[model samples]
Target: MSTERRAPLDRKRVADTALKLLNEVGLEGLTLRAIAKELDVKAPALYWHFKDKQALLDEMATEMYRRMVASAALDPADSWQERMLKANRGLRAALLSYRDGARVYSGSRFTGTDHAREMESNLRLFTASGFTLAQTVRANSTAYSYTIGFVIEEQGVKPLPGERREGYDVQERARLLAEFPLAAAAGAEIFEDYDRHFEEGLALIVAGVESWTRLG
Candidate 1:
């Protein structure tokens, strides 16, 4: 029997493994020891590539960012509203892909050149859409914050019984609906379809930016 051990590890390899682990175990369950086991290496071996788990997380965030931008290409023909909607939707989808994905990406610092380029491109897109520099910054920040905050709430620690955020607590919603018909009627539509709700919410933000550009 011949045992030649495994190949050497690199940063990308480590980050990739961490992503897989993230998908499998989620943020709370992800750890250096878990990644090491997946790679068939000692925990110390990961240190050669990543100084700590945070470094690995940064790499994972970068990788996620790269994938997001790649998939969210903007065409010159796209209107400002179109671009904004596309970008927000793409970001939400990417974050929802992995378990606790938003937590992972949101925690890491955006210091990479690729991240800078992505940010710059987005800023340019906003400016081209008639927003001032200051407005552009705020608009982008608001949209991003909204997306992250929504996802964090939406992804509530492993699929619950019903699996959707509003849909998850069916009993509570039903009780509320029975107690307050007027409020429940209005809230029911908002909670019924998450995709449509997200789009409508994003549209409201976009409309606010439009009003800002016009009135400012």
Candidate 2:
């Protein structure tokens, strides 16, 4: 840690420090005072850049989203469906990068140039693919919601001891099957192969858009 203080504290610097501290303290423990201590400044100093803690949180969310948008690639050669799959996967990966990242990202307002540009380009791709403007909006919204919601659930599940990727323990699964064979069998589908689950879910959304557009 540098004893020399960074000059001219800014919103980005403050938010960046908050994100770093978030990994250590988690969201509930994060506070303006905590952020100030990380920057080696007094708590009141941050109020110069952010009106309140919520304002700082909003900036933190926006900065995360900006990075998400920046990482997505829109290749013209790829089919619109393929591009969309990449976009959704990329979004999920971004949200999962930090501790409680999805929560921070979903908490903020995405009212900035990066978000606007990404939205415009995605709309153009959908429209160019023969979907009506309304259909495009619905498709995009559904895909975005699904990705974020899935990540929220994904992040919420804690890994159990001796378990890989948050599933029932072998003994627990056997016990569940013996007591509630039918119900457990049905629920098993929801608890396995998360990567495949996400891909198949995204495919259904894309397929629904294609099918609905053709019907119109």
* Root-mean-square deviation of every model: 3.0, 3.3
Query: Candidate 2 on 1-216: residue-level lDDT in tens?
Result: 759755678888898899889877777889999999999899999999988878888898888877776766567777778877998898887777777777777757753566776778878888888877898888888898898888777666522212344454444675768877776665545665567888989999989878877888
Off by over 4 Å in 2: 1-7, 158-177, 186-188
lDDT to native, each model: 0.78, 0.78
Off by over 4 Å in 1: 1-7, 157-167, 176-192
TM-score of 1: 0.85
